[model samples]
Target chain A: MVPSEAKKYLSKEQFIHQAFSYLEKGVEPTVKTLWLNDEIQEKITEILEHSYPKLRLRYWQHDDQTVWFLDEIGKERPISFGISVKSQRINLVKVLEFRESRGGEIHMQAFTEQFDQIKLTDDNKLNKHIDGITGATMSVSAMKKIARVALMLDKEVR
Target chain B: MKFKLALVSAALLACGTVNAAEPTNQELLDLIKSQQKEIENLKKSVEEADEKAEASVEAAEKTMSNAADSKLSFGGYGELHYNNIEDKESIDFHRFVTFMGYEFNEDIRFFSELEVEHSLSGDGKPGEVELEQAYVEIDVTDATSIKSGLFLVPVGILNETHEPPTFYGVERNPVEKNIIPSTWWEAGAGVTTELAAGITADFAIHSGLEVPNDGGVYDFNIRSGRQKVAKANADSFAYTARIKYTAIPGLELAASIQHQTDLTQGVLNADANLYTAHAIYNVDGFGIRALYAGWDVDSEQAELAGQDKQDGFFVEPSYRFNDEFGVFARYSEWDNVAGNSIDTEMEQTNVGFNYWPHQNVVFKFDLERRDGAQDGDGFNLGVGYQF
Candidate 1:
């Protein structure tokens, strides 16, 4: 996780953090899951090159805003992303941890900022076009999929 | 409740008791008991559903934890094709590859691709088992990365990301094949860094080509000179550098230059330089791509053999009907003996359609017309997938 990065926004009262989350210096979070249905399962499969392994997605929520820590395989390693959806749109998208030696540029704010106010269409496509990083097409694609899945699920639990 | 009352009514009828106007209290009591039983069953069902939901969350968390232990990830792509050239037809499993990588940490990782081409590898079989890429990359900073070991030379577009479904046509375009000699990799170290907004650069020094110096029509076949890093000669090395600009949302422009100290690795006193320029623009469903690549060799023998200068260019325009279907057409012209100036160059026109049943799986069909050198027309059919 991007400790300084996620902390900067987390302390802005975006969502109330319980005592347990702060007990271990932000080491543990109050995790919850959004169980999948046939529709969401099909969409996840479409977004991922392989089958979406997890039948249920773990997330954190307070009121209408939910934060999703999702991971997808970029090339050959899992790139973890932290996304917060409010009002059925992405308000924050951060590359929490990037394991691949390449495409680490996706973690930069210049790229992740494109997801701001991004919405999912009725047919489950991103409403806004996200520009790709040069030489980092797969990583850019993975981030987009994670954002779509986050918004689609936000429609569920929210 | 209605069905329960009906069952009660039927039971009474079966017991030889039929009442028209009013039901006895005993009948009323039985109806109440059945209604209560149905309500309890529904309540139990809801409780079971909640339990199942909890169980699902537990299973998912368990899967996540299990995934954490395995730092390695795997994926692959394969292509199988059938070609009909001049009414002569043949089929082949063109390529099959299993690629994988391991992440040692956040900033360092290892990636590799093991490829099998033409289905088999032996002394006489028309196939090869090649390690296309096996490299360890370390991030020196947020904007720079260095990779060493056998890696794909970042010379052309397809050389790096040539997964079948990613591009159109049953076969790769011939310009990139004959001129750029894509699917090419060498043992080397390279660094990629961001130079400015939307501008990136790459520089690498790697094992150089060894085009056979023996005199023949194919004396300077750039495509055949790849050592594939198998006991390669190190008498000379190649240096390559490229700069790319992708700041515009749907446009990418790049140029690359490469220099080889000795094309024959000291066998012949020949030096080579390659110049490449490419552009890609994609917006909505319409797209266009163009590439120009050329080589200049400095050797008296090569000049005498008419193999000193070689070059090619191709332009492809495509329209993606949607996420799953697209159409493309390409015009290409290339030569391996431009030094002769006899206009001995091969030109081709190809039109193709790609159907992506899934984003990573594609069915491709194409027709090609060749107008120079090799005079033949052919149709190709292929299916490819990556996971």
Candidate 2:
């Protein structure tokens, strides 16, 4: 890849780098794409309180191990974010694109880094605590939903 | 399994013919090395193809999202109200509003709100259709924007975001309506910017109020001074400035000031200024809101009419049991004729509840008590929604 091309959208590139950085040397990662079935779609809708239009998701895996689950969510508009899971625990969370006028603060590393090492509880909720940003409640809620969905999908695909 | 068996049989035969026709150890090692090299080449090709496929999907998703983002967006809010007072009972569909917005590009866009009030409009009906806001906004930078055309003045909290389902109460708080003069808009151009983290500032220059000097029923009702950009008189201009701080979670504090050079449009020697301050605290399911607003009119004519120095304040606290149920209480006091030698204070208290069937729909009920010269009690019911 060209170095100059990577600078075009820095946030997106940064997320990609972080996702792949967890891999061992010479381990080739491949993409795994899935379509939203009725059950998955219903759970997502319940969490978001709104139905999403697109029906497909793409994740990355290395040597049969799920590495990252990437998706976009909407508060007022779509926010591109990703989650990385290792041994059933979240290793990293990153916000790739933030389009809303408010809640851009959710993209800050200080906020997203808190999701690291979190696991799903018995009730399928996030086990670790997350702090919310002021005036960005909707955006923060969307991020939490994304994290839950990612954890669930990791279990299913494995 | 079949390949492994074949290799074992060949190796046994070679061992049996050690001195006869048999492969050398160096040749066997060379063959194994060649096979490993081929496998590595195949893996490299596969990885490259996978990388290309991922990049293609990413590009496609980006293109689709960009197209969707550029599409025209539509939403709106409306409300119906029923008022039962000591002297009369009335039911009215107070407002039907529609919002339309279009993005010309990433940096420029148009937004508008069209509203119909009182549910009807005719030769003898008491209703009208109006444009509450229509503005073209240009992003000057990531943190600043400039807007021009008819827009709500940045003097009050509800003026910009008063969708029915968002606020708490059956009817709007009287303090905002009577003193700050909400639902207020005018022809104007303005700039809004983030002054710091969680702090915002706005300034606007707009067509000023044009209070008629005919000494009629609306002579002292400051709420009636709004021209609403309808062939508005522009003999003199108005300037408004506001600052809001929300750096703390669950707390917002704001202040606004507005000055009109000629409240009477040069018809009477009158100039007016308004000051307003408010705070809203919302945490968990508990909330509190308080506001104080006052107006000062500098004119001999206004003073004679007892219309100078009008002021009011209100405090409201509410609790939500859950997403769908909440209750609140409020106390308000005001006097539009405060300059009069005889006291004209009007004090009121209200208790209310809101039932939300959905996040976008609400049913509201409230009971109110009014004391002073126009002492009375009333009940209000309202249903409202946004989409």
Candidate 3:
């Protein structure tokens, strides 16, 4: 079951509110949707072993230069995470919701701030090194994926 | 002739001034139209570029998301134990285990554990290799799931999350090992659900125990009845149900019951009932855990051998000086022949300290005393880790 405190963090409205709080002008950005093609969907199926869910990614673009990527990734269970990118640099990567019985420490700033200023490499991996949290390996891995994808997406848009 | 030439020059100068003074309305309108067309072209190019960029980003994110979802995960734990009884001493590589899992999707997955005990397994060897747990879990919703395969019975706290580094002491509590019969898994299928906030319920039907009716070495030793899912007797089945509450931070209360219609797998007219209850509370580096478990057997043959009822309980309190060090003391008592008229109670007291240099690694030392028909004292030391 979703924790009581975590419910407040899971809604799309809450994600948009938090995303705006991180922007300089506090401008309410409009949602932009992107649908996934077959190649990308197949790769995800291979990774997850099961068929991938709808690839319609809902994000917010600010001034056509910054993008906010919000989604849930599975770590024993699906944990909501958000990343904000500007000019190909990760401005923020935060765990918005955590449902696991343990490993809530992945939400702490000490762990989340490591993704700041990190960029993706040409091979579509994080350029900066990230240290794993003991007992929270899966959560840490999920966060890493968010940061890389957000940065890659930011590069493409710019 | 001079006057006529001056008049013509004046007329020509006047005409040139009139022409240069201003453009007509048509000329101004033509200029504005050309600029508007240039602006429109610029706007259209910008719009097209934005669309292309958005599509490209969308493709990149889709690929990355898939890669993230399909990753495989690995982890495990191991321990080495040393024991000193009276003046005799011995050391054993107790257990090593590995955990592997794969996420089929957000709602389905596979998990397994492989273990080696006593450090070796072969013909005429004291050690053995085993599969501790292998199961597939399907999530029906955010709060409920179904699991099947050789999974641990949801009876005791340690049975499901028994990695050494996750708990205290050099060995598991005796009450859990012998009476509750933990580290116990059977071929089973079950549904687990979060019944309410901080409350969870589970039920399973599995292969049942086949206790020996002759009452020899394996008579009432509930530990020996474990079938380990290897050619397990299927003449009868066991049903288990458990409920746990953890609404209060740092506190947990749980109860479990199991019923086997025939402990001898129908070979003898016997049935068994097992019940267990436990509570654990921790706050501000101080903690306490208490548990009670019992088994009742209904069989003339079992009663004749004085192996009808068995029970045990233990209480442990501990204090952690810091993240790196902690100490605890535990008292436990049990009677495997509670049906007998004789005094068959056995008791034990243990005190131990654990030092963890890292969250996943621990060094342990403990002293224990036993009181019963066969009395003994011992010292134990061990090191354990998980990743």
Which parts of model 2 are misplaced by more than 4 Å? A1-35, A49-55, A59-76, A82-96, A102-158, B1-67
Instruction: TM-score each candidate.
Output: 0.77, 0.79, 0.70
Give per-residue CA lDDT, model 2, range B149-235, as digits (tens): 999898766776677766777788887898878899999899988787668899999998887678786785778888999998899
Candidate 1: list runs displaced more than 4 Å: A1-67, A102-118, A121-137, B1-63
lDDT of 3 at B166: 62
Give the residue spans of candidate 3 off by over 4 A: A1-9, A15-78, A81-158, B1-68
Deviation in Å, model 1, residue B170 alpha carbon: 0.9
lDDT (C-alpha) at residue B366 in model 1: 94
Q: Which one wins by DockQ: 1 or 2?
A: 2
Model 3 accuracy (lDDT, Cα): 0.74
- DockQ scores of the candidates: 0.11, 0.14, 0.07
Two-chain complex of model 2, DockQ on C-alpha atoms against the true structure: 0.14
Tens digit per residue, CA lDDT, model 3, A4-35: 11322345556566656756675577677655
